[model samples]
Target: MSETVPNTTAPGRRSGGRVHRLALAGTLATVLGVSLVNGVTPAGAAEAPLSQSGKATASSSERGDLSAAAAIDGKENTRWSSAFSDPQWLQVDLGASKAIKKIVLKWENAYATAFTIQTSSGGGQWKTIHTTTAGKGGVQTLNVSATGRYVRLNTTRRSSQYGVSLWEFEVYGTGSGTATPRPSATPTTTPTTIPTKPAPTTATPPASGTNLPKGPVPPGAVRVAEFLAECPYTHRLPDDPIVMPGLSGGSHMHSFFGNTSTNADSDIKSLLKGGTTCSPKADLSSYWVPTLYSDDKPVEPTGTTFYYLGEGIKDELMAQTRPLPLGLRIVAGNAKATGVNDPTSSSRWSCLHAGEVGSSKNFVNCPAGKMLESYLDFPHCWNGKDLDSPDHKSHMSYPVNGACPASHPVIVPKLRQVLRYPVSGDPARFRLSSGPGYTMHADFFNAWPEAEMERRVRDCIRPIVKCGAGGTP
Candidate 1:
């Protein structure tokens, strides 16, 4: 996985400057009912439903049966129940900056007595727009004025011991109406028109072939390898011990696959000796990520396929790639960072045969008989020096311009991880144990026998052959 650099901008500047502008714009749109910016109608026009399209999350769920997305699913029968505690919150990402005018909450038997409606340009700092301490357990239509990409319901006091539950949490707004209004053009007696210049175009660098394996392709050769695994759900654990020490269970929740014994005490030696839950019994590696919960129950994947290939590499070049060494560990994607409205997030949600790929911000809904899918692409270039890096990410990097960089010149097989869950409906009702959908990340442990892995890479992966157990396509 590629390394991420943190943004060092001051928090005060972000909240005061950017947030203030959004608030001002939202207020104007709310009063006008239909506001136009940049010659286009905003998202809040006609009082359309906004919450259904946004991603939903919460502070903590009661169990696998009470996911936060349930509240925003537009179905009164499904409800979201938080942990039986104070200071619970339900949040939604509007996908983009929008002008919110109203919020409706349909409460279940368990409700929040004291709550506040808040908005945030990003998901971090929030500004409260409405608060009530005398909330009754029923449907509430609240008129609010705010503009943001994220809206949340912050509940402080529960009306019952059962915790806060909401059958539906609805938000209405004008979408994409939050752009700062452009100043009106000044008219002059001597009107002068300036000729507009064509925008300059910068050519993207072509894919480099420096690291490609020098060879001639065999006749009728095909290049691509895929395998299936019956990945199951395991307990959530802390980040890898080698990467983050002394922080057992400090990281977000994760659902382990393959090696069932993975935990805070796990190590390379333990993984090598541990038995696997996967088929073929010979494969002993462990793989895991934040567990996905729907309707408060853990949802496991079906028909999951793992694709191995060299990114943009020809068959001859792919044949030269080395197999993963035993005891190798790698972390892909960022779990700590929220992916809401983040287009750069590596996590992608889609459906089988849907032909459309959705990001974490706006997840795709699967039709009946179809399945929800998660896709993760791992790096293909390796440094050929260390089995692991200090940060657990530096040892591997993605191909730059379709070629490996000098520091990581060894081309290795790129892993395209696809997981399909058996649940269907609004993607909002689904979430990873780590937190929100955007916080999705994955971990992998190399536990296959050294000889077996090498043989498979040479005979199957290198030639782009699809195979499963015993390496027979």
Candidate 2:
């Protein structure tokens, strides 16, 4: 493994399903479906300080109270503090697209020396609006021209020995909602013309990916209600298409499987056009994990199995289970674990042929000839709206009382990753790119074609019948 730290970072994590949503489109002053800033004339367009009404999130926080929300709460005394690490961020999601005018940063002692300001229109893509390599601490106001629904500060380097901290991060912008009479006026301060709306995200559903032969179920079919795929280890890269999207070389080393072209900029459209290394061939979904190393040498998994099963919920709910949505991104396990017994950690390791050794949160010393194995389970509950969330999680939840929670009503097949490495024995020799074995984590980006995914759900997962890669039981 090339890096020995958590590869991904999610800034402003406090905004991801933890804060109340802003009611921008509802009850706002709109003359003809176009939201107008109150007390502002057409000639002198006023920009709403949108950050106050929006949500803020971050990758990691130094403490629970020192959250991303503090930066956008319009309170200068309060601040957001990140874990002491490089490549952290803080982002705000304006309720709607807006014409970005200016950004103000009220810095504490810990300030970013190198950073980039990025914008996005609720899509998984981002545009760089501003970047700074030489940063002066204290309060700094930046004038920039950009339009986006989200504004993020990607901090690459910190001036202080501690992590980045922001007392107040403000964004001034006008709503992107259509305006009545289509005012051609610009900002009262230097006006920069921008489009009414950003282009719609590219979301063409991909064709079914799989060519497994369809045949009648044998009398002794597995009876597991599982749809499985074998995607062996393919490559190692420092790219995370989910948490670190659009920022190349921003993550720790990762072992990739299934998709051949997954990168920092990969989205559903890009994966659909790439080749797959999976057994079924058609499932181009990308799967990755922090690379494992033993004795300072990388260890690759010889056996990789992804199981989509209807095992967590009752059969009745399984019947209502929907196919994994396209472009869905999920993360499992805690990458920031401090040790094997960290409460946030959720990883399991065992030996393939040494059952007597038992499973553990950290690496286990398997008997001779036994291979080390890792398993991670992803949640089955779906929120049904957003394909991705600010924190990479929070859009999905684990079943409550054997059923999906009301907040996340959509039931989906539970996904579990089982990986078996060829080497085992001394536990002291094993370590993941993230950390110890307890810090093992995994990431999944869904690019499976709708038709193929639905078929697997209908014929196998929903019906509680074990099916092969071709969706036949």
TM-scores for every candidate against the unseen true structure? 0.51, 0.55
Please estimate how well model 1 matches the true structure, expressed as its whole-model Cα lDDT: 0.59
Model 1 agreement with the true structure over 1-473: per-residue lDDT tens digits: 00100001110100123333443454466466644332334455444467764556678755322456456645444456677789999987665788898787767666789999999987378899999999875667687778988888999999866567776788876764311211111111111111222222122222344442322222222222333344455445655544453467765556677777777667667877777777656677778777788977887775444445433444345556776766666666666554555543566565543322222433577777667767676666767766666556666776654456788777665665666678877877877776676666677777778777666666655554434556554
- How accurate locally is residue 181 in candidate 2, as Cα lDDT from 0 to 100? 11
Clashes of 2: 13
The digit string of per-residue lDDT tens for model 2 on 203-269 reads: 3332333332222333323223467777877899998878777878888899999999999999889
The lDDT per prediction is 0.59, 0.68
Clashes of each: 11, 13
Q: Judged by lDDT against the true structure, how good is candidate 2?
A: 0.68
